[model samples]
Target: MSDPAKEYKQLKEDFVSNLTGGSIGEINLVTAIVPVSVLLWSVLQKRHSFFKPYTVNAFGLDYLINVGTVLLSFTLYSSQPLLLNALLIVPALAFYLTPPDSPTSRKKPDVPPKAKSKHGATATPDALGALPLKPFLTTYRGSMIVATCIAILAVDFRLFPRRFAKVETWGTSLMDLGVGSFVFSAGIVAARPVLKERAAGAPASPLAPRLVRSLRHSLSLLVLGVIRTLSIKGLDYAEHVSEYGVHWNFFFTLGLLPPFVAAFQSALAIVPSYAALAVVLAGLYEAALDKTELGAFVLTAPRTDLLSMNKEGIFSFFGYLAIFLAGQGAGMYMLPRNISPRPGTTKGAQRKTLLLTMAAWSAAWAALYFFATSYDYGLGLSVSRRLANLPYVLWVAAFNTAQILACCIIDTVFFPESYKAVDVSAEEEAHRGATSRLLRSFNRNGLALFLLANLLTGAVNMTVATLDAAPILATGILVGYTFVLCSVAIVLDELDISIKL
Candidate 1:
């Protein structure tokens, strides 16, 4: 055999080359830097003490650090760890920059003796007790949606490092997690409220209303995706499949499943239902592949119309449903209970509680990950987006949880004003700074940006040769693309012209 040391050296060289050569992980890091920097600066402005005067410098420093972090993350460690840490660090840095007298600035005078409920009555209840959790959840979902769009743009422009783009053999690239977690978070956000309503004996929206609007929305997007492909890339269905990996809104199918799975609400019911369904489908798919005549055909088939629609596309609906249900289960745990308002939790205590919760859950998921990957039942659990297998679901949940935990830490520590419902008024929201505006804009017009990115991707490919771009040039193009998208979306948001499905 060849020298082992030599082989490892070659592999290390290849890894470095791939990372610097526009890897997806690197691109994702790059794309995430701006939004995250904006968020950090927004928090700094909200602090309104030492930071208010240094706002410009803080923004510049945050952006510079973000850019440098991208290099360090991919070079020192992998993207995932660096990203999770970077997200968590933003709030801590904001906290550090917070002036000693900042809280005193916002502190209200002691309540009048006549108005006091008790001698020591307080205006705001503790955030740890029961903070308004919906805003946090909404922010997480919206942020993920925008981030997902950015990641996709980075990938489409041939900015993703070619080394990390090996979807077939790669067990789970950072890119895969980005896509998978986006879908999972989407499912959680979309169904969490509705499912909670059903559980609480609240009347369900009629199935026709529930699915039709969402179905139409997804269909419109699908149509737009297709038209953009045709107009920009030419009318090549086969190539579309090759490029985007099966042309259909996985979200559409996710939207369609909730009505059917409405009866399965509790973990006792939903978890087992998903488990049984996943097991049966996995068995059937495997058996069909191993033993049936159709298996041979599928194995040998090219990207024909039949294969695309049946095996590659629609067949995965079942697996996608499993992933969605898994997200619903996660949502149930993370999201606040849908109940009447009560005394809200204190921001400080809530932050501690959430940090503990996140740590415990991370550990739990890590164990699950170990079991799913190591202890195989003859049927292996692979991370197939098409199959949405057990290991895949667990891994997605694990990492998504960690990422959200990081985000929660950031929100609670730096921007505690947004921790509760009452703090978010139309006037207050309207007057928010550019960073928050950008986030909310992207959140509100998320699907629009997604579609826009698709069109833009096609347009860029048509005009420019993106494949052989240097890393710096590719990053510059990404910055410009993001600026344009954000500017348009921000204006629309300012005008309250959200293009909702």
Candidate 2:
């Protein structure tokens, strides 16, 4: 008879193997529920005072409505996502239909008094105009984190549908998108420093100093990657070697990205833009995969030496780098060019910026559609998260661009006052509502949350027979796990603690 432990390991391996993923439309819709739910809950708090306590400071109630409900929709209701989506939509529709003269509407808007220098001259637009962008990014990023944390453990159980798991070699799935999205999100945020550096007008710092700074930034991630590798090996944990290869993990991929980008800073400067550079990189990489033997080697080569052993991780780094650069380009468009607006910055200028940003993303989406469908004329490539190929890069870029655009639209529709040019104090007050507290919490301690989730996943897997657990029990375990993560995040936020790296 086979050893039970060995048998269980094989069972787990078979579970995540050979997945082709579901339709993109469905995945997009299911993902859309996260932001929509945030919008709905926010509206409920504003339109109906009764929801304020429950949706705001109360932990249990807030978790159930915001985090828990999303968890359920992604897991239990995953197969029937449309029905779940409609459920969120109905309440939002009702809130919109409510009378305009309601008590909540009667309250005076919190417009801030204009700022004046001691000399009584009008001050330039305060940094507050940038505040509206924060929640949108926070919500987008927080939702991605929550989904990833849940999916990692949930995929081990029968309760979670297989379609949402990472695909074997090709095609799109929720989890596949998560990896790219994480890279893309990091890239978007990293753009700020690049913009700041350019705005400084100083000569580019010496290469050694820049490289040192880049290495310093990557040190924590590299340390985490090492710890994860040693722990997994020491524990003899079940792993899908094909995912990152025999030893390489996602953490290593993330850790190495910064130094690699730094090394290429000069090359990137010569390119018209990061996005253009990304296109060139992805095109060249895809050609290597298609026109040469690289693709065959990655798929079929024997694992031997250090390079061969971690082929997937090494080769895929360039693709992920492209994704990150593309994200930086997107950030340049979305984020303000300077820390402070120019002296004569006007509302019309802000409006123009917003419109151009929307138009740029819309064009990206349109391009994605053309390439994704036109097999004969376009790139005509299947998306391979494994290879991080061109189609996969484009898909990740376009999908995230769409989501960012959606968040912008949601913010504009629900909180139009935020978009208006206002002083920093006034802008902060406008966006300080209870609606996005949880998301803000998640954003504050994202790295901490990710690490905790990884530790918990290992602990749970070792202690529980995840594959053998009944569906209801599996779901209960998942709910409890998610609750713990949420509670920790909330507590950290309350204490004003942000654990970086």
Q: Per-residue CA lDDT of candidate 1, range 9-118, in tens?
A: 34424433333233334545544543454455445455553233324454345334433333333323334645655764667476657664546575342232222223
- TM-score result, candidate 2: 0.87
lDDT of 1 at 319: 48
Cand. 1 Cα-lDDT: 0.51
Instruction: Give a tens-digit lDDT track for model 2, residues 135-199.
Output: 56667888777878888888899877788888878768988888998999888887777766766
Each prediction's RMSD to truth: 9.1, 6.7
